[model samples]
Target: MGAAEATDVESEYSSLVDFEGPDDPSHPFNWSLPRRVWTTAVVAVLNLIGTAASSIFETGNGQFMKEFGISHEVAVLGTSLFLAGYILGFLTFGPLSERFGRKWPLLCGLAVSSLFDLMPALGHSLPAILIGRFFGGLFGVAPVAVFGGVLSDCWPTAQRGIAMALTVSLVFSGPTWGPVFGGFIMGSSALDWRWNMWVVIIAGLSATALCVVVFPETYPPAILRRKARRLRKKTGDESIRTASDKEGLSLQEITRVYLIRPFWLFTTQPILALLTLYQSFVYGVLFLFYQTYPVAFGTNRGWATSLEYLPLLAIIVGIFVAAIGIVIHNQLYFRHHCHTPDGVFIPESRLPPMIVGGILVPIGMFWFAWTATPAVAWASPICASVVIGAGMYLLFIQGFNYIVDCYTTMANSAMGVNGSMRSIFGTVFPLFATQMVHALGVARTTTILGALSAALVPVPICFWYWGDRIRAWSSAKVATF
Candidate 1:
C-alpha cells in the first residue's frame, strides 16, 4: 500500500498501542535520571572490558614466544587477530542491536566472549590461544559497537556530551590500561600468560551479570513492541500493535537495509567517510604506540621490561582531562547555540573541541618524537603522551557526538562503519609498527605520523565552517530524533 493508504489503515486501527505521550515514563527518553545514569555506567564498563581485551595480550608476548618457540612478529598476531575480530563484531552486532535491542545482544555477546576467553586461558598451543582471542574479540564487541545507540536512546543531544566523554574515556582507557594490567599479571611469579585471559573471563562474566540484573530494554521500538504484546494480552485485543509492527521487511530487504547500508553510508557520505578515515588513522597511531612505547622507554632507556607500560598511564590521565574539557564545552557552548530561534539543533556546535584536538595530535606527536630520548628526562615523553591522550580523547568523543547529532536515528549504522574501519586500521598498524621504528628510527617514525595527522587537521576545521552545507548535500533519508 501507498503512504496515504498505510496512514489510513493505521488510523483505522483503534487498538494500536504506543506511548501515552512524549513524557510517558515507559519511554526510554523519559526514564528517570538516576536510572539512565546507571545504565550508561554499566554499558561503559562493558565497553572498557571488551576494548581492553584487544591490547592486553601484548604484555604476554614474551610468554607466547617462549611457549610456542615463535618470533616476536608471529606473536603480534594475537593482538592483530583480536582486532581483526572486532571488524566482524562491529559488522554483526551494531546492526543487530538496531534490529533486536541493545540489552540482549550486549549480554549474550559478553557471555559468549567470556566462554571463548577460556580457550586462551586453558589452551596449551599457540593456535588455540590465538583462535580464542579472535573469537573473544568477535563476541565481546557488542558493548563497544552498540554503546552510541544506548547513549542516543537514554540521553538527548543536549545532555549527551559529558556521558559520551566519560564513556569514550573508558573506551580508550581500556586499551591504554590493558597492557598495564597485563604487565602486572605477567609479572606474577605464579601466574602465567594464561592468567591475562582468565582476567578477561572474570570481568566479562561479572559485567554480564550486572547488566542482566540492572539494565532494561532501552530501544524505543523494542520497548513499544513489548508494550504492544502486553496490551494485547491484557485487553484481549489481538489488534494491539506498535508502529514498528508495520515494519516487517523481507529477507532481501533486511539484508539491504541492515547489512549493506553501513558500507553504503561510509562510501557515499563524504563527511562520514572522511571523518571515519581520520578516526581510523588516529586509532592506528594508538596501536602503533603499543609497539613503539617499549622502544622509547625500555629498549632505549634500559628501563625494566615490566615497567615500560607505565608511560601508557599518562595517556589515560589525558583522557579524563579531555572528558572535563568536553563537559566545559557543553556548558559554555551547548547552552548558547544548541538550537536556533526556530529550534533546529546546531550539530556544528560539537566541532570546536574536535578542531583543538586535531591540532594537538600533531603537536604531541612532534613533541614526543623529539623528547623520546635517553638524553632527555623520561618525564618529557610521558608529558607528550598526556597531550596525545587528551587530543585523541577529544577527537574520538566529539566525532562520535557529531555523528550521533547529525545522523540521530541512523547513528548505529554510521557507528558500525566507523568501528569496522578503525578496527581495520587498528589491526594493520601494529604489524608494521616495529618495522617502521626499526627502519626509520623512533624520532623519524613519529615525525612521519605527526605529519600525517597534521595534514588531516583541516577536517574538523572545514566541517566547523561548512558542516551544514555538507550535511545538506547528502541524499540519504535519515530520520532525526
Candidate 2:
C-alpha cells in the first residue's frame, strides 16, 4: 500500500513541465509560425514607437530655442536627455526581464513611457520638457532591452536571420522616419511643435495595446513557473517547481547578474568592445547625418522644406534594399550552414556582407562629400546616399547578428550593452554635428568622417578571421562556429 501511494505521488509530480522537451506545445520554440510572426511584428512596432520618441522631438529644436528662449546648445539637450535615459534604461531592463519575465517589464515600460511622452507638450517650461524626455527614454526600455530576447526565445537560430532582418530594418529606419513625419506636424500652420509629442503618444498607445493583446508570455522559465504553480494548486502539493525556480534566485543575485553582466561582458569581451566602438561610431554618424542632410540638400541645394525630406527616402530605400539582399544571401549561402541539428548557426556567416559594407561606407561618404557642390548634378550625390545608407544598415545588421550568435541565451544583455553605447554616441555626436560642418564645411566634414570610416575598415575582416579565436577566449562559453 505504501509503495502504491509513493508511485501515485511520483506520477502526479511528472505532470508539471519545467523545460521544453521534444514536441512540447507550450514551448515558445514549438509555437505556430503565424503566432511567432505576429508576436515579432508587435515587438517591432514597440521598438519603432519607443525609438521614435527619442528623435521626433528633433524638429522641436529650433522651436524650443525660439519659444523657450534657450540657446541652440541648451535646446539640443532635449535630444541628449532623451538618449541619456536610454543609457540608464538599457542597463536595467534586460536584468528586469531576467527576474520578472519579459511580459510585465515590457508592458510597464510602454505605459510609463507613454505617460511621459505627453509631458513635453503639457509642461510649458524647458526644465519640464527635458525632464519628461529623460523619463520617457528611461521608461521606454522595453523595446530595446527586451525585444531581442523575445526574438531569441520564439525563433530558432536558422529563422532568426530573417526575423532579425525585419527587426533591424525597422529599427535603423526609425530615426530617419521620425523627422520625415515630424516635419509635417511641425510644418502645419494650425499647430505647433508640441503636436509632435502627441503623435508619439498615439503611437505608443497603439503599440502598447497591441503588445498586451497580441503578445502572450514569451520567457520559457516564466511559462514553466506558471505551469508549476498551476500544478501545485491542482494537486494539493507545494513541491511543484520549474527549472528556473529550482535555482532559488534571490533578488540580490538577480540584480547582480542582470546588472553587472552587461558591463562585465562589455569590458571583458574583446568582441563586444571592438564591435561596440565601431557600431557606436557608425550610429553616431547616422544621427550626425540628420544635421548634414538638411545642409547638403535644404540650404546648400535650395530645396523646398516640403521636399527636403525626399533625400532621406533614398536612405530608407538603401536600408530596405540591403535587407532584401541579406535575405537573399541567407538563402544562397546560409540555407544549410545557418542551421544545424543541434540548433547552432554559423557566426562568421554574418561577416561577408559586413566586409562589403565596411568598404561601401567610405566610398559613399567620399562620393557624397566631394560632389555635394551645387554645380554638380544632385542625382550624383543623391545616389551616393543610397550607398552610404546601405553600408550603414548592413554594418548594423551584421554587427547585431554576430553578437547575438556569440551569446545566444544572453543575446538580450549583449544588445543592451551594445545599445547603451550606441545611445551614448547618438546623444553626443548630434550635439557637435552642426558645429563640425560649420567649422570644416560640409565637404571637409564628410571627408573627415569618411577617413574615420576607412580607418575602421579592418574591424569586420578581423572579426571574420579571428572571431572564433576571440570567442574561445571569452568567458561567455559560446559554441564553436
If scored against the real structure, what TM-score would every candidate get? 0.93, 0.91
The Cα local distance difference test for each model comes to 0.87, 0.83
Off by over 4 Å in 1: 2-14, 233-236, 476-481
lDDT of 1 at 394: 87
Which candidate ranks first by TM-score, i.e. highest? 1
Candidate 2 local lDDT, 1-481, one digit each (tens) = 5999988866645545666566798989899999999888888878878887777787767777889888877877787788889898998888788777888899889889989977798989778888999999899867778887788889986688889887888878888887777767766778788888888888788777776876799998888888888888898687676656545567776665667777777877888888889999998998888778778877898876545656877787889899999998887887766556897656887899998899999999999999988989989888999999899999999888888778766677778889899989988998998889888888999999999999999999998899778877774443321
lDDT of 1 by residue, 1-481 (tens): 8999988887756566778899999888898999999999989988888888889888888888898899888889989988898998998998788788889998999899899889888888778888998998899887888887898799986687778878889987888888889877876789888888889889989878877987898999999889888888898888788776776689998777778888888877888889999999999999999889888987899877678888999999989999998888888877697788998888888898899999999999999999999999999999999999999998998898787677766777788889999999999998889889989889999999999999999999999999898888763444321
Q: Total clashing residue pairs per candidate? A: 0, 0
